[model samples]
Every structure is written in C-alpha cells, then in structure tokens.
Target: LVVLLVRLHLTGFFWGDCSLSNTLFRRSAGEFAAYLVDAETGELHGVLSYGQRAYDLDLLSTNVFGELLDLQAGELLDADVDPATLVARIGERYDDLWRALTDVEEFSVDEMWRIEQRIERLNRLGFDVDELDIVTDWDGATVRIQPKVVEAEHHARRLQGLTGLDVEESQARRLLNDLDAFAAAHGLQAEDPMIIAHRWVTDVYEPLRAMIPDPLRGIVEPAEMYHDILVHRWFLSERAGDEVDFFDAARSYVESILPARAATVSAAETSGPDELSAVSPSDDDPSFD
Candidate 1:
C-alpha cells in the first residue's frame, strides 16, 4: 500500500480517498503488490506540493482508521490487532520509505563510493534510480546527492533482458540466482551473457519445466514451482549431507508436496533432457509407484 502511494505521489498524483477498499492486490512472486482500484477521488497535478502529499497521507490514515474500527466493532478484526498502532505504523513506514527513496544525502568528498552504494541499495529494494541530482559545496569538500527519478521492477527488467522471462521482481531475483548458479556449475562464467542465458533456458530451465505433469500444471505457476524445487533441493541436500540430483529432488517434491493430481506422472513422464536423463526417475521410485 505504501509503495503504491509513494509511487503515485512521486508522479504527482494525489489519491484523495485512499484506503484498503480502494486498492487491489496481486501476487508478485510471493509478495503482494498493490494497485489502485478506485481513483474517483484522485487528482493529477503538474507536481504535488508538500501540503498535497501530507493531506493525501492524512486522508489515508483517517479512512483506514475508521474502517479498522468498524471491522473491530463488527467482530471481523483480529482481537490482537490495534487499529491505532497499525495506522501509525503505516505512516511510519511511509515516512521511512519515502525518505529512503527521495531524501538527499551529504557526505565527504572522499566518500564518493556512497553514490554507487545508494543506487545499489535502491536496486536491492526493487527500484531503479533513473536520475540523480548531485551538488558539491563551494569548497568541494562535501557532496549532496539525491535521486531525481526512480522506478521499480529493477530485477524483473534485468531477468527479462537476460532470459526473456516476464516475472515478478522477487521471482526474477530468485531465478537470476539460479541462473548464476547454473553458469558457475557449468564453468560458463566467462561465456557471452546471452549465450549463457540461452543455454540455461534450454539445458536447465526448460528441462525442469517439462517434468511438470499436465494434471498438476494448474496448481502452481512455472516460475514459482521452479523456485519451490530449488528450495526443496536445498533441504534435501542438507538432509543427505551432499548435493541431491535435481531429478531425484524434483521427484520427491511432486509426490510429497503436490496434491493427488501429481500421482499420474509416471517415471517415464518425469524423464527430462539428455543432461538430466542420466539421473532419471526409476519405475520403482516411490513417487512413481
């Protein structure tokens, strides 16, 4: 909610009536990304002044507080939830994130590395610092820096460029890590980035994707399923005190984690590309049986 509001405010949009009821959420990787549902009370200006932003935030707090109180009165809210505390926390988080995204920083001339560090921090927060404003003191002993323009979806763009996968930001980050691991595992670190990405897609990503049986395909997204398999592999590897083969790990995932629909995938159906087929699921494997 705060992220959506901040982005709107950055773009000079004032949501006059902001509340839970006015927003819709969609899954972004494993996290929720907020979107405006009803903008009837919103106003777009050349640039919102400080007072405009403050009024919008205040209105949000007021609406949310009243709604929360109504929920509490109707016995719809959790007993432990404190409406006032939640409202205050929302404001606090908004302020903190707003500062991080827009506030200027002053540092000694010798600490120029802080500029790149700031951009890196923003990138990690899923934002791309598109423009920056930097000023130096008359004596040039100190510098002031602030981001002028910023946008989100940092990791998503990079992943899409590398592998043409249009996924949520967090999911893209997860998949990128896997892709890096794939490159390192195959000694392809020095290869052309595009070639490595294509190889990863063909040899690693697609092969694993093909193992997902048709019956279970609707249960989870491909990227999310892959992420879960990576997590499953980690746990299996930890339990076995060594790296588990990917196919074996995936077999365990299908049988133990997925629903009854997974039982239809036979050992032969789980067989993947040539690289993964070496450790193919056997007919007597518990998952297939």
Candidate 2:
C-alpha cells in the first residue's frame, strides 16, 4: 500500500480517499504488490504539493484505522494485527520511500563513485533513475545529487527488453540472474545479449513452460514456477551431491510441489514422469548447464 501511494505521488497524483478497500494486492514473485483500484477521488496535477500528499496520507490512516477497528469488533481481524501500529507505520514507510527516491545527497568531490552507488541502490529497490540533477559547490569541493525523474520496474523492463518476458520486478531479477548464469554456463557470455536471451528463452524457459500441464497452469504464474523450479533444482542437486538436470528438476516440481497448492490436477492428464520425459529436450539442446 505504501509503495503504491509513493509511486502515485511521484507521478503527480493525489489519491484523496486512500484506503485498503480502494487498493488491490497481488503476489509479485514472493512479495505483494499494491494497485489502486478505486481512483474515484484522485486528481492529477503538474505536481503535488506537500500538503496534498499529507492529506492523502491522513485519509489513509483514518480510513484504515476505522476499517481495522470495525473488523476487530466483529472478531474478523487477525490476532496479531494492531490497528494503531499498522496505521502509524503507513506514514512512516511512505516517508522513508519518498525520501529514498527524491532526497538530495551531498558528498566530497573525490567521492564521485557515490553517483553510481546511488543508481545501483535505486535499481536494487526496483526503481530506475531516468534523470539526475547534480550540482557542484562554488568552491568545487563538494557535490550534491538528486534524482529528478525516476521510474519503477527497473529489472522488469530489462528482462522484457532481453527476452520479452513481462513479469514482476523480483521475478524478473531472479530470471535475469538465471539468464546470466545460462549465458556463462553455455560459454555465450561473449555473444550478443539479444542472441543469448533468445537462446535462453527457447532452450531454457519455453521448454519448461510447455511441460506445465493444463490442469496445473493456474496453480502459480509461469515465471514464478520457473523460479521455484530453479530453487528446487538447487536443493535436489545438493541432496544428490551433483547438479540435477533442469528438466528433471522441473518434472519433480510439477509432480511434487504443485500438488501441494490448492489446485488439483486430473490423473489422466497430469504431466507424469513419462509424459515429461517424452517432451524433454535432447541432451544436445545446450541448456543442460
């Protein structure tokens, strides 16, 4: 909720009636992402003043506090939930994120590497520093820098550009790491990035996606399933004292992990070992590593 509010404020949007009921949450990788659902009272401007942002935060606190209290009275609230603490923390989280995005930092002229460090920090936070404002003191002894224009989904955009996979930021980050490993493992690190990404998509990603049974498709998202399979592969590899084959790992995941989810698969159409083995790539497919 705080992240959604921060991004909306960044784009000069004022959500007048911010509340939990006005937002929707979805699983992004392992983390939850918030989206504004009812923007009926929202307004757009060239820029929002401090007072406008403050007003939105106030409304959030008020509406959420009342809602939580109502739930508590009805015995519907979680036992660990404290309406007061959660409401107070919302503003605190918002301020921390806003400052991290827009605050200016001053440093000695010799510490120019801080600029790259700052960009890396923002990227790690799933934001891109599109434009930065850097100023030097009159004496040239110190420099100040702030991000002027920032955007979110830094890793998602990069992953999409490379492989055309539109996924959540954290999932993209995980997939990109696997992509890098794919390139390195196959000795394609020196090849063109687009070409390498294409190879990874065809040999690594798409094959696993095709192996997912129709009945199991909706148990989790495709990208997240791929990530979980990678994690499962690591554990399987460790247990066997050797690297587990990717296809075998994926089959194991579909048969073992997916059934534990709420969805059930029909026995006749499930991707059993023989079905997956039939669709598995050839040994020479070049994604083995």
- Candidate 1 lDDT score at position 39: 93
Output candidate 2 Cα RMSD: 8.4
Please report the candidate that would top lDDT against the real structure. Answer: 2
Best by TM-score: 2
Please list the residue runs of candidate 1 whose C-alpha ends up more than 4 Å from where it truly belongs after superposition.
65-84, 215-219, 238-242, 260-289
User: Which whole-number lDDT from 0 to 100 does residue 187 have in model 1?
Assistant: 97
lDDT of all predictions: 0.82, 0.85
Question: For model 2, what is the C-alpha lDDT against the true structure?
Answer: 0.85
How many clashing residue pairs appear in each of the predictions shown? 0, 0
Backbone-clash count (model 2): 0
Candidate 1 scores a C-alpha RMSD against the true structure in Å of 9.3
lDDT of 2 at 94: 88
The runs of at least 3 residues in candidate 2 whose Cα sits more than 4 Å from the true structure, single-residue gaps closed, are 68-78, 216-220, 234-243, 259-289
State the lDDT of candidate 2 residue by residue for 1-289, as single tens digits.
8888999999999999998889987656556678999988899998999999999999999999999999899876878999999999998998989999999999999999999999999999889999999999999999999999999999999999999999988789999999999999999999999999999999989998898788767666789778778877887888899999989999987876665432322332476644554544455422222
lDDT of 1 at 40: 94
Error of 1 at 193 (Å): 2.5
